[model samples]
Target: MSRGSTLAEKIIGRAAGHAVQPGDLAVVAVGMAMSVDSIAPSVIKVMREEFRIPKVADPEKVALFVDHVAPACNVSTAEGQAEVRRFAAEQGIRHLYDVGTGVCHQLMIDRGLARAGEVVLGSDSHSTAYGAIGAFGTGMGATDIALAFATGKTWLRVPETMKVELTGQLPAGVMSKDAILHLIGRLGIDGATYRAVEFYGAEDLTAASRITLCSMTTELGAKAGMIAFPQERLAEFGLPEWLFADPDAGYVHAETIDLAALSPQVSSPDDVDNVSSVDAVVGIHIDQVFLGTCTNGRLEDIHAAARILKGRRVAPHVRMIIIPASDDILKQSVADGSLISLLEAGATVSTPGCGPCIGRHQGVLAAGEACFSTANRNFRGRMGSPEADIYLGSPLTAAATALEGKIADPRNYL
Candidate 1:
């Protein structure tokens, strides 16, 4: 008799072209390996010195994005981006998304490089964002990414699956950010260490929400996170799937989230797991509101903010910054007038890249400032000064906070 396999085991086994079980070490072919501008220079150097590889094994499957510091914040960052561009050009890498494109994860999905049942690796921690479309995407160190570029293969141990079954409907005022923050609060930051999180009963989740959920799994120490069903646009990738777990699939642990009970949630300053409802923390003043990142920078997120900001202006005391995740999303917002609404609300619209998420030049917080952002992490000093505070929330919450200049419930604005 054969043992039942979880979705993680099934996908890893298929990618490895053999049977695999949890904890089994396997070398599997990779569908894609990517890096952003900040990491690509080191990755390319390692590939040149350590491997001495002449050409990449599959240039078509390798990508580099000039997103982390797109449009070059300074001479140093510009030089880094130039090196990445030179390497991509010399190596014949076909999928390089240069300045003005977008974040690496969004570009991977938009270009069809990441798809269901395929394994994708990136140098950034948020590489797991690709899991939103059912790909087994995870972060890799520079050495592993360099090797993947040279050989198109990477090794890994099959991780156990942790089932997170979300039931009931999300309330109108609450968003995916609230649901994920609620989960993190319940499970803690280290709850699913080194395990694949498989989301079930999320049939109501939109593509944007699913992406947001999967992106934050990294904060919970998950190896990867995924929703079980195929995305509506999955067929466009031309990939095969063994995407579902067996009926009797084994999981290391299982958790159920009742979405009906979750309200608008936020991660308070300096800790992602320190979650509380918006009502609990209301009236705490904010200096800025950032409304974009790989975690929540899609068109849907922009529209959500726009719906609340329509015919309204941000508070005089608050500085609101909005950025789109990709060029396509930016164009969509423009075509649909969401961009105008946001701008009319006194929000500053930046380029289609990682804006202030990395604490780079765009909107770095001054000391003692408090920022409400849609980005994933909220550790101390994550957004510039160690003295500044960061609160992580949904776009709805961020927009509402901008209007009120405080920690405000999006429900009131909705």
Candidate 2:
């Protein structure tokens, strides 16, 4: 059988300065290593023990953020932040984003910490977001990340590629998150395990939406996620154009999806791949609506929600919240009118942070209460009490649900 070129293969190939073949072992070099407060301390301990070095290879190469425990909700979280602060100072890492910065992924991309064709790894699964900028990025465990910190290298088993050909325009009110959810429904949660997904054939996606799509590949258990570099898209980042694949590039698996017919899809509570269209449960009531996360918390996502909620108020029974991905996004939204629109609609706007996504500091849900959110994970008790129900969707769907106080099809409002 002929071998296929996966995105991971291509990236590892370039990083190792060799043409990577399928099943070949490669030692790839990464350009950046990032961690959030939840995982940074553990990685620091591993670096100290395994590397046997008092400090990291390059402190600036490690970017740390406190977004996971932002605003220091309690004494324990405050202590965690203290530990991160002391470690950063001791390691001399200058790119630390403290309480005010935002979600680590958004900050990294917004500040140009990630560049095209470079290998970037993070302790958070949504690290795949950098693929939107034509970079090869993925998430790893804290121990693996710590090893990368010590040696500036990591071993990878080149994975097979899966080509997801997205044809046709997305339906009105349907965004990339819905599209990905629909895919998960068809492929199941473990379908892409240890493989790379390369999205192609959709030419109309904005750079922000493309990143949102790639970021969720982690939910499918993909090794990494990437998109071909369209010149116009690359230009948005002021990045140089690069070829993602040759015309005849091979793929182990290929599937074509016509997105024009897809509806606003939702992943059921607790299981990411248990997807159903909004039509499947049209009148389901929800207690909260959350719009923000590494996946869909970018400026464009907020603008999309604001357009839908501009003249309306959220349903009286629902508590709506909007969290921007970063402080810069928050500042821009304030200047651009989206923030005011959200507030006018009776929605609370939070500072840039992971917030309710991690279930630690903000927007914890009561038992049996349901929420529609834009965050990536919806595991059991991810947002609060074990009995709370969490539905995952795009920011557009989340906003519409807030207005309707139920699982809603955003097309009605759009």
Candidate 3:
């Protein structure tokens, strides 16, 4: 009899052309490999110098991005992006998403580069974002990515699986961002170290919501995050019959969370795991409110914040910034007037990319300041100054914080 295998195992098995189990090391063919501008130079150098490869194994399967420090913050960054562009041109890599196109992960999904039951590797940690669409997405270092680019195959140790099951519907005013933060808090920073987290239930999660859930799973130290994506929704992708975990598969750790019982959750400064209820952290002044990132910068999140900021303007001392996930989402927001509404509410909008989330450019915080950001990851010095602090929350909470200039809860405004 065939042994039951988890989603990660099955997808990997397909890629490796054989059945696999946890702890098995296998070299699998990659469906796609993405590299961001910040690290593309390293990958390019490694491929040329180490492997002496004339070009990547498959140009169609490779992607590059100029998201971090986009728009050329300085001479150094501008030169670095130029190098990436040169390589893409020389290698005929047609998928190089240049500055302001959006975050690499968002563009990958929007462009249909990642699909269900495929193996997508990225140079960015948030490559787990691909899991929202049921892809086996994981991040790798420069050398590994270069090797994959040169050979279209890479070896990986199959990780044990962890099950995160959600039952019941999300309560009023509660966002998927809140649920992830709460889960991360419970599991601690390193809770699921090197583990593949497979989500069950939450069948109604929108594509955007699923992306948020999987993207933030990286905060739990997860190697990959997979949701049993609704098959009907991804019909065009022709997802395999066994995209989900087998019924009899085992889990290293299983956690059950009732979505209906959840409320707005937040992660405090210096650490994503430093979490507490919004009620516990209210009244603390927030100098800035940033509502965008690969985690929560999708259309749904923008709509939620627009609804909150519709008839109100941001508080006097609070600086609100909103950057959509991609140009497509940005255009959609404009067509729907959400962008104007947010701008009218005294919120500043920036180029469609990873704006200020990586402490590089586009809204970096000042010393002694605090920011309420919808982006994942809030470790010390993540956004800007090490002395500054960041509070991670949902779009609703972020809008409320912008209105009240403090760590305010979304429930009150809702």
Tens-place lDDT digits, model 2, residues 19-75:
887678888888888888888878888888866666778776788899987988888
Candidate of highest TM-score: 3
Residues 1-414 of candidate 3: C-alpha lDDT, one tens digit per residue = 567888899889999999988889988999999999899999999998998987899999999999887788999999999999999999999999998899889999999998778889999899999888889999999999999999999999898999999999998889889889999999998998899998887558787998999998888899899987544644554567668677888789999889999989989978899989888998889999999989999999899999999989999999999999999999999999988889999999888889999999989889999999999988889898999999999999999999999888888887
Give the poorly placed runs of model 2, Cα more than 4 Å off.
1-6, 230-242
**What is the Å distance of residue 212 in model 2 from its true position?**
0.8
lDDT for position 336 in model 2 = 95
* Ten residues in sequence with the least summed lDDT for candidate 2: 1-10
Count backbone clashes in candidate 3.
0
Candidate 2 structure lDDT: 0.84
Instruction: State the C-alpha lDDT per candidate.
Output: 0.88, 0.84, 0.90
Give lDDT for model 1. 0.88
